[model samples]
Each structure stands twice: as C-alpha cells, then as structure tokens.
Target: MAYATLEALIKQYGLDAVLLVADRDQDGDIDADVVEDALTAATSEIDSYVGVKHRLPLPQVPDVLVRVCGDIALYRMSSEGGQLTEDKRQRYEDAVDYLKRVAAGTASLGLATPPEQETSGDAWFEAQPVRFGRLL
Candidate 1:
C-alpha cells in the first residue's frame, strides 16, 4: 500500500493545489492515476530508506511518514507539471534528509524491532517400547 493517500495529500496541500499539479489533461479535476503514480513512487523511495532500519511494509503507517510521503509526492507532481516551486523543492529535500536520518539511526520511527528467530544445532528421536519383547 502507498504510504500516503490522495486524501492525505489533499489534507496537507489542499485539493486545489493537488489538482493544479496532477491534472495533466487539464480536465479541471484531479487525475487519480497521476496522483497514485506519484504516491507509489514516493512510497518506493520511502521504503528504500526506511527498509534500512525498519521492516518492509510497516504494520502501521506513521503520521510522520504520511506527511513526508505527501511532501515527496507533491514535489514530484509539481516537477512533472512544470510548476515546481522553491518551497516544494525544499520540502522534498527535507523529507529525503529526514529519511536519511532515519536510515542512519539518527531519527526514530518509534517502531519496536521484531524479535529475531531462534535456531538450535541439536536433534533427537524417540521410539515406542517394543511390545513383543520377551520378559527377562
């Protein structure tokens, strides 16, 4: 699943801003595919960094990641729409910087590490007592 949804993006950047950057056909509405593409790409990028520390496909989406993903996806859409602004660029950079910090263990996702599996180098076998044995 994508780290950020279109609703999350709209919540962060406003619906008009999303449409402005995502309406590639000039249809006066948000193109779901366009937004999904950006969000999917952003999610993959997030995984690359977050995977270094956390497991793939986190059990729950962090609020921080949702905001970061929104920023990254919005930056991507703006760049594709030829409307990239300094603020969008800076937000993208900041998101990536935070991801780097996460990868470097300088930042926290507040998720507990999964327990490691246990293994042993021993084996044993058991057998039922023979029923036909003669009494001593």
Candidate 2:
C-alpha cells in the first residue's frame, strides 16, 4: 500500500493546495498522474532510510509515514515547477530529519519488532518486599 494517498494529501493540505502543486497539465483539476509520480518518488526516498532498520515494504503504513510522505511528495511537485515555497521546503526537511532519526534507532514507528530483528537483549527483573530489621 502507498504510504500516502492523493485523498489524504487533499485532506491534509486541502484540495486547492494539492491542485496548485499537482496540476502540472493545468487542466483545472489535480493531475493525479503527476501526484502519483511524486508519491512514488517520496516512497522510494522513505524506503531508503526506513529499510535500514525495518523490513522493506512495511506490512503496515504507519500514520506518521503518511504525513511524511505527503510532505515529501508535495515538495517534490512544487520543486519541479520552481514553485517551492518556504513552508514546503521546511516540511520536507523535517520529514527527512525524522526518517534519519528512525533509521538511526533514535526514534520509533511504534511497531513491534520481530524477535529476530530486535537489537537489545531481553530484560527481566524481580523484586521482593523489604524485610523489617526489628518488629514490636
């Protein structure tokens, strides 16, 4: 499944905003093909970072990935036309920074890692009630 969908992009940034970036053909509507290409590129960029710590083609698309993908795809679309806005560039940079942290194991996707892929050793601890030194 795609990390982010066109519908989600429209919902997050509004249809007008999506059209402004994605309507490359200027057909008075969002050019879904253009959006799809941007999304595909964004997904590949994310996979490059995430694949380092997690399996490729993640079984489930995390919500955070959805937002990051949207940011990246929109930025790519805007950049292609030299219409890149400060906000779009900032969002794209933030998404990449977050992905880098995830790849470095400093952040988490909140998914349970497989036992075999877990890097830290299992830990267990037991505690006993304290004993009184003196009793009345």
| Each model's Cα RMSD | 8.9, 11.1
TM-score of each: 0.83, 0.84
Clash count (model 1, backbone only): 0
Query: Residue 96 of candidate 1: its Cα lDDT?
Result: 99
Clash list (residue pairs), candidate 1:
none
Which ranges in model 1 have alpha carbons more than 4 Å from their true place? Answer: 116-136
Instruction: Assess candidate 1 and give its lDDT.
Output: 0.90
Predicted candidate 2 versus true structure: per-residue lDDT over 1-136, tens digit per residue: 5689999999889998898988877888888889999999999999999988888778799999999999999999999967899999999999999999999989998876645457567763457877867576
Global lDDT scores for all candidate models: 0.90, 0.89
**Cα miss at 120, model 1 (Å)?**
17
Candidate 2 Cα deviation (angstroms), residue 39: 0.5
